[model samples]
Target: MQNTVSSTEAKPKKKSLKARMQKFGSFLSGMVMPNIGAFIAWGLITAIFIPGGWAPNAGLATMVKPMVTFLLPLMIGYTGGEIIAGHRGGVVGAIATMGVIVGTSTPMFIGAMIMGPLGGWLIKKWDDAVQPHIRQGFEMLVNNFAAGILGMILAILGFFIMGPIVAAASAIMGAGVNYIISVHLLPLANIFIEPAKILFLNNAINQGILTPLGLEAASHAGKSILFLLEPDPGPGLGVLLAFSIFGKGTAKASAPSAAIIHFFGGIHEIYFPYVLMKPALFLAVIAGGVTGTTVFSVMNVGLKATPSPGSIFTLLAMSPKSVSNFIGLILGVTLAAAASFIVSAIILRRDKTPDTDAASLEDATAQMSAMKSGDSSEASSENIENARDVVANYDNVKKIIFACDAGMGSSAMGASLLRDKVKKAGIDMSVTNTAINNLKDEPGLLVVTQDELADRAAQKAPNAMRIAVDNFLSSPKYDSIVLNLKARDQMDSSAAEPKPAPAAKSTPSGALDNIDFAKISEIDFLRDDDKVGTATMATSLMKDRVKKNSKAATVKSLGINDIEDDENRLVIVTPEAAKNLKTRYTNIQVFSTKDLLNSPDYDKMVSELK
Candidate 1:
């Protein structure tokens, strides 16, 4: 009896439904307020810079434009990436940021059109190719570079391919808008659709229409819908009326929060939870959406691109000349709201209160806490041993990838950092960084990224192990990460079925001694240097060989002097000679062409050869 009393005492008292609803309402308010501030900032920036009349001073433009176009997108991308992949997913997040900036600024919507899909694809690809061999030092670096290159290439390709598709999609969307206005706004349909519009359509029209066009047409057109109503109702007023009349308990609680967000914050995301809670009322929301959109279309209401979720804050950002558009917006929102409230109340009047799953909620909360503490009971020793067995029996594990957004800046830096760390630990890992969108599934792949982008990696390679890193390129603590990865790899190897070894062939050296001489001849002698001396030296060395061979006359120097001191230094050669060289050389040193240009010995050798 004492034990039972102690257990009972440990449990906290449950809050009243009213208190819970109030808390949720407060949470909604907090969430929407910051978003409103961000939307206002975006609007002000767009108004001042984006081909509009409100130009700032030249100095301000220089500072503001970069902040808005570059930094803001990057920050958003990083945040979004984190949301998807985890905290370590910043690499992919950064890439997504680059994509957004490029896509938005590039001609004919190039960056805007292709960045998201491309970034997503590259993350997936990098995850598949590099996740497995991440433990190997040299292999990790190679894989990192490969992933980066592949991501960039894929982004460019996707941009080209997706351009026409986006154009077509835009055209279709426009046509659909026209159809909805013409067919769905009839008086009979307005009975249901108008109420549905109040629930969501008003905000959609504002966000989907006005913001994209940089116009303020919706507000003005909203007046017509009001003129037709018995009490001269505004657009979203109907939704309010419906809520007042029919909403109960939580629905009633959500109504005021929705009003605050819709009216002041211009955010529509808030209403979704309410709609989800009562799916039977979804048609009501749709009805309101159609009503609002149709009314706006009929009245020729439009707005400038203010991508913030629709609320009153968005309306305030519109041009002063757009009073009519604002009026139309109000009408649409009010009408839709009233309709939804009435429909929701009517539908739910006779129904019992929906069952709440307390156990599931408690379980979810517990799991979340466990994840935070890194204490999953399911990850037991026996399971780990089994996983290792599977991995040991498996074959063809070759690559490990680190993925980010642009695949240039952050991913490259991250890859380099990871390479150094892994090397120091004496791990023979293959790691690479790529854009998130270019991933393809492969065996023996492991993916490491900022925690935010893990979801994207998982989507690409379901079987691959994903390790989250807090920092992309800098190391405060990657040692633990490496150890965790090794353990995972061992488990996977142990779990997989073993495959037969290939037939062996007798050669001059052991398999470990195998070297491709042709690769050595064509190897870039200067890849790292930025000085002209490096290029000069490499060129003089090649020239000396050419001069000595003359026709040994088939060997000719082809602009070895012309190599630049840039990031990329590719050496092209005929297939026959390349193959021969690969057969001879086991390893190659990469040098920058700049080294040759600055070398005194190269200058002397070139003179002698000449």
Candidate 2:
């Protein structure tokens, strides 16, 4: 009883920490995700339209300042505000942001992020407080005037108070970076950066902090090394290379492909999960980051602008068009990769799991997940074993989705990774990704998300099977999921025996009699005993087998009662279900499952669709 009580008490604390992290991640994502287009726009203008750029158009380049100084800050403010309190909040937030942008010589992006949301929150509070007291006749009057007054006061605060503070902060941050460079201690930046990157804070550090500093430096010197710190792929490259060589089982096989994607494809996020798979790998990434920073500092090299994708090609293209700069870029990347690879290889070799046993993998997975969950107590053997049961319900899911705060970068790559594995195994599973906000529960759907965002994903798709992993790029969970799906497929194929071979030609009775139709649709699978399980051996049983073949116009909006009472649409079910329904409902036409599955040209149609 004491143990159970203790365990119960621990769960809320774990949930609380997770909630805080999720909120922070959401806040940071809100600030960065919507503004990525602006970043890309500025990067392109700086890279190709500036005087030193490939196109070198001074006229077009004039748009850079307006875009950065006015447009970018305003957009950031608007987005932050909109996140807090909708459009009214966004308007005031942009207004308040101007105060910070006006006095600062540097880009005031970080300041905008703070001030915009603050302005929004202030207005939101005022509205919330005054909402009940306001008279009906004074609604518009109070709303408009209050908003304007709030906007003006906040603007003043931004200019007089927040503006100077931001300038000072920027100066201090810039000076610190410069001092490190001056002392030849630039490589130390990785000490802080590597750990932050591992925490999924790469976007915040790069876009929120470093970009402004790098832009300021670049404005004067035409280039800055600060741009590379957060976006650098070298450390990630090294880690993946090490894993490819020294990792066990599925990790070993996946690492090589991940390495190619991280290094050449310009997706640094691909390697983050690899490091997460083994937390000890953090030291390897840190060493590699330091090595790369040191090499770049030594060579006095910098890019003309930030490399958006952090791709090798983009990095090379943005390098100062000079031999020394080119050499610095190559040396930095190579050395970083080598340093990280060496350290990671040592760590992997030292921690080598010789057997790749399921129990061992579960413990390792639990440890990783527990660390990600911010729960220290979950490291026990019993807790680790229990974690394995979290996904037991997902064993036969047909569609898997990788979800993230932002749908594109890491989630997309993860889905692609699984899609390739599924396709190679000749499974017709659908694998994809979407933003967590867009996630929805569906029959037979499994949602995979980073453990940090698992709570949000669960809230969004409660009915879907959820697999939360510490990292998307690599997780033991993926291996388990794949193995389970393959096993289900094998079982399915074996179940087809003893039944008559599927009618090659369209008979009145068709493949539907054998296929588990409920597994493919929104309907629940019901057995004669009302138990739900795959009743057939052919694991490759098609989905929507009835609906896809016949023009059995589906009334998707109909409720169970509507389907029972109305005769407007055909209701397809197994013969047993049809018999059960016939005694109660006289109006609707009931089609046999086999008859629907054996629609005209059934074999050709099924083959073609497959």
Candidate 3:
């Protein structure tokens, strides 16, 4: 129900913790992803102009050093600042970053990430404190002088303090990477890499952490193995190959198409659902990763740059135009895929579990969350806590934002899709897309995020009404939202278009078997512990149905112990909640449903209520 968990519940906070880590990792990447074009330009120049490169132009090679040392880190700082305080932030961020840049021979990406945000924050705080007190006509003068002075101070601080500290940290990290490579222990990183990728943290790991390390290593050695770790599609390719041959029904049919998109189109996200459907596939990917890395290590191959989409062509393009490295790279990818496919095939053939398709992405997430929290029994039922975490009132919803790890791709497309639907429905609303880290909690804010990202969205915007969707391209949730908005005009006057999707079988078999209808004057949805959100939603739905049908019964969601034991009152709950309620009440009529969020049976029961 309401996603509120009981204080005494022993559930692990793994989901929330993972979300926070994802958020932080994404923050690091957010500074770099936007500047990928710059990174690519430098990559291309290095690939073609260095003495060992194909064209071997010493003059163009000079561009490589300055680009990597100055242009890239400055861009990162500017972008990072832009994220914090907008245009002014970018200016000061670059100024602050220049300090760190001139202070060290190493690339200043990590330093820029820190100083840029710090610079923006300082200016923002100063402006907040000083702007209001400034005379109206002198706003521009005061702001300009303030930014310049602050930038100078921050630049001095960065050159003197943050720069060396970050340099030492980077040096330590570089030494660690060198040690890992020397001992051939880097391949073991895939144990964490493959799993985090499934959680949609691939970009964060690759661009945020690995890319910087790769850049640092590549500058000296002309290439880095760090870049290949996260972007290598070998393990995912192997898992998909197994799924196509061994997966059954929807999963099998979808595998071929997903595989094509993942391998050719470079959308690795396409295969995540497949691996998640059968978590044993984790071993397959991990095996593939280990095998692939071992192969890469033995062959002495590395990419000159990070592959953006992890597509084969991109990977090939980023690799040095050398036959030996090319063959080694291909061999690594092939061996990795073969390793994963073998493990995945055996696991798939032996386990005859029903297919879990892309459509059930959210369900899979909740179940996985449950399992991780050590509550496997709750996995068979609906969400341990309902998907919709309603900390704010729907009536306060005035703005809707679609959020994702990277704000540019899916979230934008999803926002545009929903914006069109809202427009078509004649609703005036601001539909926008933003990075999850940028979520601002305020009244009238509603956030729609991809199924896997729901937890992160919640932690960011707990005060915003939230909706999680399986696919941004098409979703009944979008229609339901539009209908809910339209229904605001006549919340109870008539049943708004029966929800976009069929309402959970209309009636769960035998759930409402023996209920006395005429005697009940009020229907109560029990809200306790994790059931608060669900109970609140179910109660609202029932009230809408009763009002639409002109029924006499009133519906409300209340604490489980708040309702008195009365024959005239009816209580609706999940089977688990029903048991707890029954322990406390003898006369109140209690009914149960496996899915409280989408039960049409409640509509039926409400219509028949006195």
Candidate 4:
């Protein structure tokens, strides 16, 4: 049965003024909240790992340390893009976003600090340069490639200059923080703040105050409102309050999820829906947040780094040396949660409800079921059946190539992950990591890399099917590679029970029928004295044959610099195959694997001959 609401439902009412304000606040909170996880992680690491005698870790030194450095900057870039351009804009938007992250954290705010503006500038430049140039046919693809290049270049430049500036700024900020806490705030803060921290606010102040100052010892401390509060007091109290005030319905139902999420996941985004629905409740949250921050500040209950939000795990991970700080964090979180719940409940109790609560529940359930069904169908069709089924046969696959910049870091990691995954899938494909420059013109080559680098791979191997990974190391998104492999395997399997071979066909260039000159060993132009020049000339000579015949072909030449004979054409070899060819022929023209696969001229020539 078709649901009437799906077809002609009226738009939900415009959010009230208070609702809008709450949303704005939520957005603000979102910016700060998500970073809490990072902060907690850093703080915990510092508290546990860093030596006491060493200089207090600040943003400069800490940010560059391995996973946090790369991940945090990238996250900033991605998140910034999302905020500005929604999801699609995120691609270029992230470049600008990283700028903000760095700028906000850096000391003198010079050098790589300019990355934020540079990223923004590059996005604008790309938009201007390509948006109008985009036209029909292959031009669209080209323009997209140009934009990606522009974004990447801008990101690299921005990071290069900004990284140091930000680092310096971070150092300064850290020094300043140490000064403030040790000289000014610690003495008084430790007394009152420690007590209040038991409720959760002590941690809040520590983070909020230290983060901007660049003294964020605990990474999570400065990232979110809840991070300042202790987990137990904050989320646990919130749960009880949600139940007592909102009652045992959907609002109540969501409360537990919110509690779990805020307590464990450290995601404040989950609580956004609740605040959006009840605008007045926003003030309560702020009051709770401020109260929590103040208490945390006075108690001097510090965390190690940021985690998600106010999750107990994060606080525990980042807590300072003193056990009292942990106690403060718990007390602070509980108090804040309790306070928020009380205020929210009091405000909600007076509201009247319709008598059809049961009906509402039934309708909600039905809607949820329908949504689930639709989602399932879409996932099956788009994510699984069509895209994934293309390459099912994995056994026959001989080689897997991973392409990326410098052929290091992310690509290496991705290849390793894929190898493990393929092994589990019972596929015996050999995986190798290489730069785009090293790709050969071989048959059955698979190029895998991040979407940003796909264009370069395509240029190197135009005929090879490219699989774009969403992230460097995410396993779920690796399905595209797996599916493509599976598809290829299936094709191989199908072809294994081959029918009778077709009659040989000759090419317009008089090349042997169906024979790839590139694969043939008979061609030997390498004997020519001017081998480099002859090989260079051979590429053009073979262009016509390549255009006419879609078979493996090559022009070679002898190494002698003086020879000017046509035989010299046989010695041409691509850079990659040069070593292999050097041992056999004095001079040889070797068509690259890519050249054989992508030579449209060969396809044309072969088609004409047929």
In terms of lDDT, which candidate is strongest?
Answer: 3
Off by over 4 Å in 2: 1-26, 132-142, 350-352, 357-407, 415-447, 455-465, 470-610
1-610 per-residue lDDT for model 2 (tens digits)? 1110111132222445645655565575566666776766676777788876778898999988887788878888988887788898898899999988886777777788888899889989999999789988999999989989998898898888998998898788888888989999878889989987777667656765677678677766778999888777888988888877878765776788887877777777777767876899899999999999999999988886667667888788777656888899999999999999999989988994564522444334433432332321122111222323322354447798998765667888789878887786567899999767557777678788876676666566666666676667765456445544654554455466666333211113443353332222222122222211232211113345534655232223221222333343344445555543342234444444543323453454333321
Using lDDT as the yardstick, the better of models 1 and 4 is 4
Instruction: Encode model 4's per-residue lDDT on 114-194: one tens digit a residue.
Output: 343345445655666767766667666775676577666655655565555566666675666567555534333333433
Q: Which candidate do you rate higher for TM-score, 1 or 2? A: 2
Residue-level error in angstroms, candidate 3, position 345: 0.8
| Model with the higher lDDT, candidate 1 or 2 | 2
Candidate 1: lDDT of 288?
60
lDDT of 4: 0.46
Best by TM-score: 3
- In model 1, which runs have C-alpha deviations exceeding 4 angstroms? 1-40, 48-117, 120-124, 131-140, 175-287, 306-309, 318-320, 338-610
**Ordered list by lDDT, greatest first:** 3, 2, 4, 1
Which one wins by TM-score: 2 or 3? 3
Tens-digit per-residue lDDT, 248-284, candidate 1? 5434544664555445653333344445555666666
RMSD list, candidates in order: 28.0, 12.9, 12.2, 24.3
For 1-610, candidate 3 gives per-residue lDDT tens digits of 2222221222333466777788788888899887887888889899999997889988888999999899999999998888889999889999999999998888898898899988888888888899889988999999999999999999999999999999999999999889988999989999999999888898899889899889988988899888889888889899988988988766676678667767775667667777876788899999999999989988888998888878888889899878999999999999999999999999999996656532444333333332322321121122224322211134456889988887755577678888998897677889999888788776777788777787777667766667666556444456446544543433322245564322111123345656778788988876645655676787787778889999898887765424655778887777766544433344677777777777767666766776
Instruction: Report how far off residue 391 is in candidate 3 (Å).
Output: 20
The model with the greater lDDT, 2 or 4, is 2
lDDT for each candidate structure: 0.41, 0.67, 0.76, 0.46
